[model samples]
Target: MTEIHVRDLRTADPADAAAYAAVRRASVPAMPATAESVAYTCVHAHPDARYRALVAEADGEVVGTAQVGLAHDSPEPGQGYLNVYVHPERTGLGAGSLLVRTAEEFLTHEGATALYTWVLDTPRNRAFAARRGYRASRTAQFLRLDLARAALPPLADPPPGVELRTAADFRDDPRPLFALDAETAADEPSDVPAEFDDYAYWLTETWRHPLLNHELTTVAVVDGEPAAFTLAHTDGDGRYASGMTGTARAHRGRGLAKLAKNASLHRAREAGCTEAFTGNDTENGPMVAINRWFGYEVFDTEVRHVRAVG
Candidate 1:
């Protein structure tokens, strides 16, 4: 008999976070994760989002996990997410299904009307989601750059009215950056739209995240206001990622977003980051072109899947 059972993740237990991180890293190396970051997210998620983390145990050994939450910031209500990952070597034991089943039960009780998730772009993975009644939607690509070996373009002088600054320069106030983020996020491609409206929540859940490398996060300023930015995150092991890079609608055509990202990437490389990673929606041609120009190559693709919940 299979001994697989799913239960709530014990955020206070060090082993839980480690096991969760292990499963994620083993299942999708292209996705970035750390034990501390996982725990921090569990502890800091906004209450209205109804965030819940679940772990599947096979005879007392952790084998899979699911992070379920509602898209509280989305203008359209009743949208939720359930991202499940099982240890690469521990699949085929029903852990993944069990995690999904348990997560859906909870989300349904929360009044979620629709569910969305990401499945790695592999034959088996895609088929699994299809069989579960989840239809494929938009696709996204994960790109990687050998920061230590690639030749980055020379830094270009900003336009007369634009200036480049690191995130740390806005220590006294980050509201302007928040506005820029919200504006750009509204244009991102996704099955469920996301909005950034809660300033306090954003400060705790994002700005202060342990992995957020403020010194390496570059911002483009126009007339003393944030116009574009590249938020940087590093795991302190020489691996860095551009968590988000966006240009406000008002600053879209001047290449300020590219300038901000380039500045951040240069700083990350100098800080011993041997590799850098970022992702973009397949429909986002402009950003995709920018990353390609940055010497990044698409290494992995993930397909979004959606299902209606009762």
Candidate 2:
């Protein structure tokens, strides 16, 4: 008889990180992840988050993983999230169920009143979430672009008084970029309201993230002030992902965000990245249209599901 159980992932173990990353990559190819990034997340999560990387083992082999945590940045209390993925080859072995059960128990104990997760938009996945009593919410799409061959839009010169630079240019002081990011994040559509006032947390979690590629991240500066920016993440392989693209509220209608993204994508292709990926909420029509114009296609979709923890 096969036995399956879930436990907190050993963050410092390289092998554990590798196994967790392997399962995630095999389960969702569109989502780019690496051992280094996984380990970083496991170790660097905020204390308020009560974060846990849970792994499911079947006969002592890791085959499923989940990221469970409280939404520390949310304005509301008792909001939590848990995303689970199992190795495609190891499905039907009860690994996923064990992981979910373990994660829910942890979140409930952590004072979570609501639990949210993303389920791949498929019949089986949808049915599984439904059985778990999670009601469907918003939908998000994973978009991909052939960065190696697709004809990316030509990089255009910045308008007068506007200059283009990489994130590395702001290495001395990234506070401006942080402010812009906070504004954009606040404007983003989400079920849970996010507040980004903690600069220390932002520096630790976002700016210093392992996957961030400062050289490929483009920023638009207007008259020496940061206006818009596009963050880039790469796995040292050919895969590149747009982490975020946002224009300051004052800088809207100037095409600054689009300009920054185009510049970043061009730099990514030139840097030998073969594939580019990004995600957008279905409600974000403007961003979806921008990505569509960049030759990205919807490769997969995931529906956000939520349930109240009794």
What TM-score against the true fold does each predicted structure earn?
Answer: 0.97, 0.98
For model 2 the local lDDT of residue 36 reads: 89
Maximum-lDDT candidate: 2
Off by over 4 Å in 2: none
Expressed as tens digits, the lDDT of each residue in 1-310 for candidate 2 is 7899889888789899989999988887777788889999988999999999999999999999999999999999999999999988988998888888888999999999999999999999999999999999999999999999989988899898899999999899999989989999999989999999999899989999998999999999998888999999998889999899989889898989999999999888889999999999999988998999999999889999999987
Model 2 RMSD in Å is 0.9
Pairing residues by index, what is the TM-score of model 2?
Answer: 0.98
lDDT for 9 in candidate 2 is: 87
Tell me the spans in candidate 1 whose CA falls farther than 4 Å from its real position.
none
lDDT of 1 by residue, 1-310 (tens): 7799999889898888888888887887666678898899999988988999899999999999899999999989999899999898998999999998888889899999999999989998888899889999999998999999989988888989999999899889988888888888889987888888888888998899988999999999999999999999898778898889999887788899899899888888888999999999999999999999999998789999999978
In candidate 1, what residue range of length 10 has the lowest lDDT sum?
Answer: 24-33
